[model samples]
Target: MKLLKSKWNFACLLVSVIWLASVNAVALDARKVEVRGLFKNAAILQVNGQQRMLKVGQTSPEGIKLIAADSKQAEIEIDGKRTVLSLSKKIAATFSEAALGEARIPAGRNGHYFTTGMINNQSVKLLVDTGASSIALNSIVAKQLGIDYLTSPRYVGVATASGTTRGYRVTLREVTVGGITLNNVIAVVTEGEFPRDILLGNTFLSELDMKVESGVLILQAKY
Candidate 1:
């Protein structure tokens, strides 16, 4: 009995250590990076938690080099690994490590953009809507996602396709797209037809760097 207990304790300790290491890896994705906002003849980049402004031929302290940048995407070389980073898309933490960073989605034939997204860990189909002020979800989708809008703060008016309507603004605990995850995102939930598809609005889109190319919409995160 004593021997069995000792072995069990050791196994538990090993599992805990592995779990912690995994968590640390996710939190400290040192190689993962995204483009923030941009400017003419230059780009603002978020790398390793530091903000950097680089021209077409600039490099960061952590060894991120801006090979080229346009309205569509920024090409960066990290640790000798080169990747085309779309605005708001996160690429590998360490360049040349693996094609592990960044998320890419081709546009549909409809000429509109769409991608799979996650809200509070629930899978959702998101339609990219640049004109939208913020991410909007209908009450039905909110309930399906297990969001409690009744408990949210006082409602506010939101301008929709139909007209102005009342909506509840709440901070989403977590939102994930193409493996890039952001937390504490403010979203609006209104009554009616919003359940068909979640709108990917600027509330989250503004935080990412975005560009269009060859019928593709790319989004990259700054960090």
Candidate 2:
């Protein structure tokens, strides 16, 4: 009975040591993960300085799994902990925190700064327009985004290059540009598709600090 008891204690000690080593290994791997690029249903990751491209539902050799991805961000699972990563900025903490976010938009071929952003959880192309008083979109685009502007009680007139047209003022639930997000943003929906792209106007831009560097537009949330 004494010999059997000794064997049991040794086995328990060995198991505890192995479990501790496994936990340490996971922590080390988590520290090495860096998001390099983001795409629809895919992400480029750098683990321990080695780059790896992982599509949705794929896992890297280092045990990092890409859960979901889009131009804005990537969702990854490492060591059973899920985290969202972004290409625009490196955040030390999870996005659930009210930590400020920054985004860099490089100039396009037309010498205009454009980016893919989220409006009400849906992806949309955005054009930075400082002259616009409020976030503006065409009635067609608004309908595709499920915005019921026709029923909105706030009716207004919007001036277009052609002439003055009907418009509806509404509040957006959320608008996210890169890592910066704002809630309850006022916007205008014009009756016709004059502005080719969604105008990211002053209503959203006013809340952020904007600067131009090397033809790149950097938008950082003030709060």
Pick by lDDT: which candidate is best?
2
lDDT of 1: 0.71
Winning candidate number (TM-score): 2
Which digits, one per residue and each the tens of the lDDT, describe model 2 over residues 1-223?
A: 9999999999999999999999998777565777755556655567787656666887877788889987777899987999987763552222211223766667779988777677886657789999999999999999999999998998888888999999899999999776577899999999989677899999999999988876768788887
Instruction: Give a tens-digit lDDT track for model 1, residues 1-223.
Output: 9999999999999999999999998776566576753333445567776556565676776678888875556788876888886666343221111111233445778878876656886556788888878888998889889999879877898776788878998889988665356899988999877436798898988888776656556677766
Q: What are the TM-scores, per candidate, against the unseen true structure?
A: 0.53, 0.60
CA lDDT, candidate 2, residue 30: 60
Q: Supply the TM-score for candidate 2.
A: 0.60
In model 1, which range of ten residues has the least summed lDDT?
92-101
Superposition TM-score, candidate 1 onto the true structure? 0.53
Taken over the whole model, the C-alpha lDDT of each candidate is 0.71, 0.79
Lowest summed lDDT window (length 10), candidate 2: 91-100
